[model samples]
Target: MNFKIFPALVLAAAVTLSAPVGLQAQSDDPAAERIPIMRSNGMVLRAAPRASGDEAIAAAQTFVDNFAALPALFEDPAFPGNTQPAAWDNFDAFVGIFDEARQGAEAALAAAQAGDMNGYSAGIQTVAATCSACHGPYRRQ
Candidate 1:
């Protein structure tokens, strides 16, 4: 084989082999595009709890049900990559914090929908505890 032609073919083969690998890795990423959206929505919703209520309580219930997705925001995509910055620490701790809050939110929404004043009050307390506990640990000034 001619040296020049051999080098060119080798380069071409390498590129062909690498392109799909890169695309496959990207496409398979579980966190891709999810973490940022979750993070943004968490901030937005927390800032405006009233937004959670503006929709009919029925619609709010649906939103509250999906709250489990919130913790994805703080996750680092390139976790363990040497060149990447540190990912958020204690994901399980953060999840516990958010899960409590999410449950309270769901409970509150449910109570409000049922028009149960006592349940609503209790739900509010639960929600407050959830927010304060998580915020105490992870929220920064």
Candidate 2:
């Protein structure tokens, strides 16, 4: 019950619990890491159009944050197994899709904040389309 020992133990336990989840997402296999993020974003994007302004804003924020995790997950040579080599060949364009998605998410968030639900819905849908644009040519069977 010593105060010093108690806080240290709590910190240690939290780190112990978190390390595996963090490490697993950073695993060598891109698919393992990418699939969950994609699914989560898909859920948000799918529901965002029907969501209220506040809900759409929240979804957009989640997408903005999620963007940070994606770029590092794919590289030129070693990428998600489902990714076609064409993505690497047209790497700049491929990367631009992600940037465009993030920007669209940001626009959605801004529109929701400004009380423009129509703009918000449109922006969110545009962001969702980025997946198809990238995957159409870039995803292998």
**How well does each candidate superpose onto the true structure, as a TM-score?**
0.47, 0.75
What are the lDDT scores of the predictions, listed in order?
0.51, 0.76
Q: Candidate 1 at 45: error in angstroms?
A: 9.4
How much does candidate 2 score in TM-score? 0.75
lDDT of 2 by residue, 61-99 (tens): 777766656665666366547788887788888888889
In candidate 1, what are the lDDT values of residues 1-141, reduced to their tens digit?
788799899986874453232222234443443444334335534543443343435333433543555444335445322212222566676667667767766776777677654665565566556655655555543
Off by over 4 Å in 2: 1-27
After best superposition, candidate 1 residue 123: deviation in angstroms?
A: 1.2
Error of 1 at 101 (Å): 1.0
Poorest 10 consecutive residues by lDDT, candidate 2: 15-24
Clashing pairs in 1: none
